[model samples]
Structures are given as structure tokens and as C-alpha cells.
Target: MESAFTKYTPTEPQIPPMCITLTKFLTTRIQETYNVCKRENPTNIKNCLTNPFEARHNYGLDNERNELIVYRHDIIGTFNSFEGKEFSMSPYTISRYEVIEKLGQGTFGQVFKCYDHINNRFCALKILKNKKAYLRQGLLECATLSMLNTYFDSNNDRIVKMYDHFMYCDHLCISFELLNQNLYQYAKERRHIGLELNDIQKKLIQLLEAVECCSKAGIIHCDVKPENILMTENGELKLIDLGSSCFENYTLYSYIQSRHYRAPEVVFNNRYNNAIDMWSVGCIIAELFLGVPLFPADSEFDLIVRFVEMLGMPSDEIIKNGKIADRYFKLVKRTNKYRLKESFEFEWENNIKLPPHKNYLYYSSLHDVIMKNPMKLSLNTKENNFIIRECLLDLLQRILVYDPKERLTPNQALNHPFFTFKNINDITPKDFYEWTPPEREFPFKVYGHSVSADPEDMLSDAFENKIIINKKLTNSEYYNVFFTLLQAGHVANITIDNPFEYGSITPKQFIRVFNHQFSKPSIPKVSTDVPRSFVAQIYSVTDSFNSVPIKKEENPLTIKHCNQSKIIIHRMTDNK
Candidate 1:
């Protein structure tokens, strides 16, 4: 009998001593049991002896945790059972909060007023949808909100306060202080029947104070339109909608301003800073007084034109430093056909038109309407032509300057006499809200709602409104291709009529001919170091003044200086 214990030899050297001791103890017990049961039955004694060892082995196997511990050889010492920590439910996740009403939907989220169940407070909860398309936009909104929340955390009265942010499964909830209504709705309701000058001054002061708060924090509310300015129930002006806002040092690669209130520098593709906000503030002021946008052009180009029409074109020196100098200057329409050939002359009566609306009656159209006006309060009291003409028109004109750098800053506007009133802070919210107008009942239905109005239609309308001006200006046959090349900064000029050809040519042949005309000057050097032949080949394809066929071998040497010059000139000349 080969022993069954032979196969059960200790596998680990460290456990050999313990295994031997256990085996000895088990054998002694088995021998005693066998001796006691020898007279009864030899087979029964053998079975009883093996059964004790087997039962002991089975008991060790029954404890899985203990078995793993024993396998680790106790090198890690004693094992303690782990218990998970208890987590409390988020306050927002509770279903006890009462939903009062929906506020308005933002670009990627919807806002609603809800009563907090935990705190029993009224708060506005902005629910952000985790949609794939708006992921980046949603992130931007969160970043902006978090930044603003940190900055305004200390100030409670002047700024809208962010209460809490909670995550419920896939949704993110942003809680903020509940406010009454935005200035857009307020202004729309009170159009025509303007607020009393005293009340307006009070509101302006509150707005200025809010501006001061932002400026102190080194923030610029890039989007300062009426929709972003909110009115508290107390009539205090609070700046809201930090989604389009950024720090003073931040520069958005793309423009992020409302079209109507966009600064001229922004419209012209110029790099802008805090001054753009001032321009928006001016637009808001103009809207408040005149009941409409100051420069309501049909398109961006038209808007720029309207701005220039009101404030006059910027100086060449001003244009050069701006980002749009290379691109926009070429596109700006020149209307100054009245310049004198010899010396300067002024003819005020025939050239100037009476300032457009009733608002112009208080300011001089010439002095206060554009470049010359510096947004100051009208001091003239007389209703005579000179006084009436020198008052509001001039004041408003200074506010609407095309050059943002030249426009009145928020602080500067605050100090102006227009805002100088004894009881400026005394005006309450009830004064502005309670004094209702007849127009309050009639809301203008601007955007039509229909299932047919899909994203394609909206996109088409946007493209038509934004790009049609450029397209219409470039109506010549080669304008599209030529303009594209020009935008890329090439130096070639485009002519409508080819001096070498009399008949109309196809676009391909036109390119070939154009390429041939501007062919590079022949390289005189024959040194192998310069690759003169390769250079010449490259110049041959790119230097053409007409459309020309290009070969693969000559591609490396082709100068293909696309006619960026033509685009610039076309842009300059096309601004009708």
C-alpha cells in the first residue's frame, strides 16, 4: 500500500515544518483510534481515522476568506473585512422640490424656477442636456459659470448668485438666484413711452455699478445686450448670462457678439477687447432712448456701413493697427466722393440730413452724431434749432462711434452729466416696472414657429444674411476663385479683360493664361546648390498671370502666388 499521504507533500519550503507537525498529530490520533477499534473491526477503524483528517480538510476549504489568507502565508499579517462608506443623497436629487414655472431655454440648456425642498428657498435651476452635438458648448457654459461663481461668490446684492451645482445621473443641475426679467423684455414692454429721466438715471447708475463690479474683477461681459441685463424685483440691475463673457486676458478665436450690438471692430474681423462691451452698452442706451437699434442694418457689411454713416470712417492709422485692416479695409465702401481737389471746404446745409428720429431733436447732427461727438449730456435748454440740434443727436452719436477704441468706456459714460442726478439711486424697481405703457400688451412676433422651419432653412437664412453681401460684390466670372486666392495673401492682380485675349475663355484656360502671364523672372544662377532648374519649374506653374495647366514635375518649383492682390483690390472697390 502506497500511502495516500505521499501525494500530499508540502509544496512550499516555509510550510514544511507546520505540515510535518500536523501530520504527526494526525497519525498519533489515528493510531490511538485504530488501537481502540482494533478488536471491533480493522476496516471500520481505518475509515474512522481517515474521516477525521478528511473532515478537517473540508472544514478549512469551507472558509474561502481564511483559505486565501492562509495561501498568502500571513506575510501581509491579519486581514480586516472592508465595508463601504454610506453616502447621503444630494438635496437636488430629492423629489420634494416644487417646480413653479419654466424660465427660458438657453443654447444648450433649459432654466426653471424651483422651490428647494431642503432649504425651502426659491432658486432657478438650469438643467443641461448631455447631448453629443452640444458637448463642447455645454463645457464652455460650465467653465464660464464656475469662473463667475468664484468671482461673485462674495458679492450678493449686485450680482446674480450661484447657489449650488449637483449631478443627477447624466444631468448637471446649476442652481442660481431667481431674478424677475431681462432688460430686453422690460424695454420691449416700455418702448415709445420712455422711462422718466430720473428713473433712467437710477437704472443707469445700477448698471454702471454692476459694470464696476465686473471691471474690478477683471472680467468683460462681451455680450452686453439687453437680454443679458436682468432686473431684480427690487429694480436693481444685475448682469447675467456669463456664457458669452470672459476674463480681460481671454481672447475668443471666433466672434461671440450679438449681430445688432456687435462692435465695428468685431464686424470688420478686428481683434477686440473690453471696448466692445462699451459699444454694446451704447447700443443698449440708444435702444432705450430711441426705441430701436441705433444701426439696424440688414447685413454685417451694411451694419458697418451704417456705423460709418453715423460715426464716419475710421482713420487709416486706426485701421492699420486693427486686425481687419488687411481684410476689411479692402471691403469698406468709400462714400467720400465730395473731397475737395485743392483745399478743404465745409458745406453743412446740403450735405447733412436732419438726424433721423425724434431722438435727434435734442442734439446737433453734425457735432454730436459721429466721429466728433463724445457722448456727453446735452446742456442746451433752448428749443431753438441750434440748441435742439446740438443736444441728444450729438450725445447719442458719440455713444455709437464705430471705432471701439474711440467709444466711451463704461466708467466714462457713468461720469457723464446725463447720469448726473441728485436722486439717481432713489429710483426703485417699482418705478420702472409699474409705469406700464400701451405697447406692453402687444408683443412683436418676430420669429415664426412652424414645423417647416427646420435647421436647414435657418442656416440658409443665416448664410444669406451673412455671406450674400460678399457674393453679390464679387459677381465677375473669376471673382470667386480670384477672391479666394486673394484672401490667402498672394500678390497677383486680376483684370476683368485679358490684354492678350479678345474672346471669352473657359475658367481652366483663364487660369492657364493667367499663370503664363505672371511667370517668374528667369533664374540667372546655374549653381547646383540653389536647384535653379527646380526653382524655375516651380515659378513657371505659379508665376502665370493666366490659367495654365500644371505638371506634377513642376509642382515643387511652382510659385503659384494666387492673386490675393486682386481680392484686396476687389474688396476695396466692391464696397458700393
Candidate 2:
């Protein structure tokens, strides 16, 4: 074999220009050979082989410029790998808003008073962080805020307005109308300067109006402390912080009002409605008169004690319906033994001198004036304790009724004698503004909705129908209707079978039922029963014999044994 191979020398194949791949493969083989020798133990297969691509670069014969050009693609690709994965700009990011200053920060987000550069408008931008805990809180706040914004925008004037909301990256942003000072700051400044009685009365009336608007919307601002109220640039009052507020239909399992302002019903953990806000209003009104919170207690127990001291011990009826009544009231140590006077004593460290008679006597006298409805005095009264006190007491007492149901509604309060002053019909919008505090500002620049409509009319027209459309028909309607019908002994049993089901009754019929039922003096007592058989339609039978069919046989009359007299009534119609 050696003699034959000696005469034959093989020629090498023609090589094309060396490409990157070929160069890498050749370099890898050379590195592998060196590694195998360095390892010494050739049996190590892993050490014998090396990754060509990962090996250090080799110096090329070509100049630096050429070399740079050759590896340009590789370098660029490595740098650009993260372009789409780690970061990218979204369509909404085309325009950037200017950040003026940070308004406030909470666990979930930070609010910034920003100027929308694109729109040339000021907005409060809420930037929420994307975290599990923060996301949930953000979602809740967003829902509440969105609803509030919609409500205020629909009737914009003095309420906080939401502009827009969006998500950027992991952050959710909500923008609202930028506001100046909250009610807390306003009160602080006023307390330092001292508020006049006229100023106090004006603010109180504005607050009551705002509360009345909320009530009309069927929303209860569960949190109505000074902190939640806001002032605009112009002199007007606006209620804010609807995050803790709830719809009339919402049933909160846990109580959540501020300690000092919390109503007694809330303290006892009893079921409560919008009247909770009235209690807060009463507290605020009392604070305005005394220049401090009326029931500023340290603990829940102390709060209850303070309330009892001022309002007198709650009747057993109230206690039974309260939140912690069983715990605090039932405990003999905390019970009636501690009289109202003792509770009042515990509130203050020392005997504080009361304000001058001229300053506070008016408020004290006015307490029960409205509820009692005493005759109005002529404008030329002597201004004695009896006359002045009657006016003030009447106004305050109506606003501060213990029973929420008995409390004068905002509309009712507006119609009271307090607003029945001289030039009552001549008061202009400008005059109203003049009456408002300079430091206070309306949240809304433009009032979008009509305030002239009757409060009851604000309720959905569907409420008039037996099958209320878009509204929940409470048992209150049925109770009222039943009682009125009961007075007649024999009355129509109106069946409201799914009022929401359209075409069942005309809108006119619905309104008739609603007005008729709602006007009743008392709710009726009626028994209801479920039928055993499936019947899609309901029918009334005054007499069973009238509906019975008679059968006869030919030749001799055959009297069939009558099964136990049972009647089945059916109303067959296309409507069914």
C-alpha cells in the first residue's frame, strides 16, 4: 500500500471567499485541539471540544475599518435585542403632560396636579403603581371615583370633576379637575381668624344644599367631615371625597364613618342609610357654633358617652338598633349609671367659660324652633332671647333631628323660615355668591343640570310603574299600597310581576300606581302565598261558582259524584 500511494499526490478543493461561518468553524477546531492537549487526560470528551462562537476573537489581516465593517451587524443585533421586549412607547404616549406638583400620595398611587400641555388644561393626575395590594385598592378607588366624577359632571357645580383615565405601562392614571384647598384647610384658617355668625350661617346653608343634591342623586356621602369638603377658586361650596360614599342600594356590612362624626346608629353597628350624613352635618353645625367638634371623644366608648351627654341618653329603641349597643350599652358598668352630665364632664378637662350670651344664645334658642313650627315674628321684633332663640333653635333642631326619618329633608329645610328673610324673592345669583365665604370656591365652574326640578321628580319615571324600569322597587311602595287598599276592605290586588319586563304595563299606569301608593298614610298588612302548580298567568276569582261549567247527560239526568269542590282559575290571553 505504501509503494502504490507514493506515486499519487491528491490536489486540494478550490476554496470560496471565507465567510463568517467557515471562519468560526475553523477557529473552533483549532481551539479544541489546544484544549485537548492542555487537559492532558485525553479521555475527557467535554474538555476536548469547545464552542467556536464563544471563543475569543482573532486579529484579522485586514485593517481596522474593514474589521469593524465585518462585525457591524453582530454588534447592532446584540444591542437592539431588548428594543421590543423590555420597553416600547404606546400610542397614547405621543403627547406628554407637564407635571406641576405632587398633590398627595397614598398606598396605591400618587396624585399630581398636572397641566395637560396638549389640551392646555389643569388636571389632577393620579398615578397608580402596579402591585397586588395597590391594584385592588386602586380598582376600588377608581370605581368610586368614576361614579362620582360622572355624577358631578352631570350636575357640575362645586363637585370634583374627573377629566380622563388611562393606563401607561404598569401605572394606571386618573385625571381630575385640579382643586385648591379642602374643607379642613378652610376651617383651620377660619378658626384662627374667628368666623362671624353670618359667615357660619352662609357656609351651613351651602353645605346643606350640597348634601341635598347628593340625597337627590340617591348617594350617601358616608364621609362628610370638613376634610372631605373642598373649595373652588370662586366663592362656592362643594362636597368631595366620595371614595367612602355609597349608593342608596349599597348595603355595607361594616360601619365606616369618622369617629367624631360617626352617627350613633353606626356606633351601635345597626343598619343605617343616608341619614348618617345628617348626623355628620349636625356635628359640623355644632362645631361651627362652638368653634370645635361637639363630640370629640378619644375612643368608641368615649364617643358614645359624649353623644349621650349632649343629645341625652339614647332611647332603648335606638340602642337596640345600634352597632355596639349590645357590647357597650349592655355592660352595666358603661350603662345608665353614667348619666348624661357625667359623660359631659368626662369630655372637658376643666370647666370652660361659655361664649357670650349674644354669640351663642341665638343658636340655643333656635334648636327646637323649626320642629315645633312656632309662629314667625314680624321683622320689627324686640330681638329678645325668646324671639332670637326661637329662630335659631328652629333651624338647628330641624337639621339635627335624632331620627333620620323625622329629620327635615334638604328640600324641606330650604323651604323653612330661616331662608324666608327680607328680599327673599329678590336674591340674585350674585347675592348668593356675596353671601358665600371668600376663601370658599365652587368646584364646578358651570352648573349643567337644572336645580328647579322637584326632588321627588328627580326619581326615575319608571318608578311610577308597577314594574319599575331601571330602578329597584323597594317594599316601601307595596307596603304603602296595601295599607291604602286595606282601608277599603275590598280593593284590587295589583300584581307587579317583573315591572322591568317591558310592555307589561304602560308608563302611565306605572306612575299612577306609584303616586297612589306613595301618598298613603300607612303601609298595609297583607299575607302572601306561593301556588303549588306552575301558572305563567295570574287570575282573580271573586266567586268560584261563576267559573264552573255545567254538564248534562241525555235521557236521565246523571249527577256525577262531585269531587271535593276545588276551583282552578286561569286568565288565558295573548299577553301571557
lDDT of each: 0.43, 0.44
TM-scores, each model vs. reference:
0.47, 0.48
lDDT of 1 at 69: 8
Candidate 2 regions exceeding 4 Å error are 1-95, 106-109, 128-155, 168-172, 331-390, 422-576
> Candidate 1 lDDT (Cα, whole model)?
0.43
Clashes of each: 38, 20
TM-score of 2: 0.48
Which candidate ranks first by TM-score, i.e. highest? 2
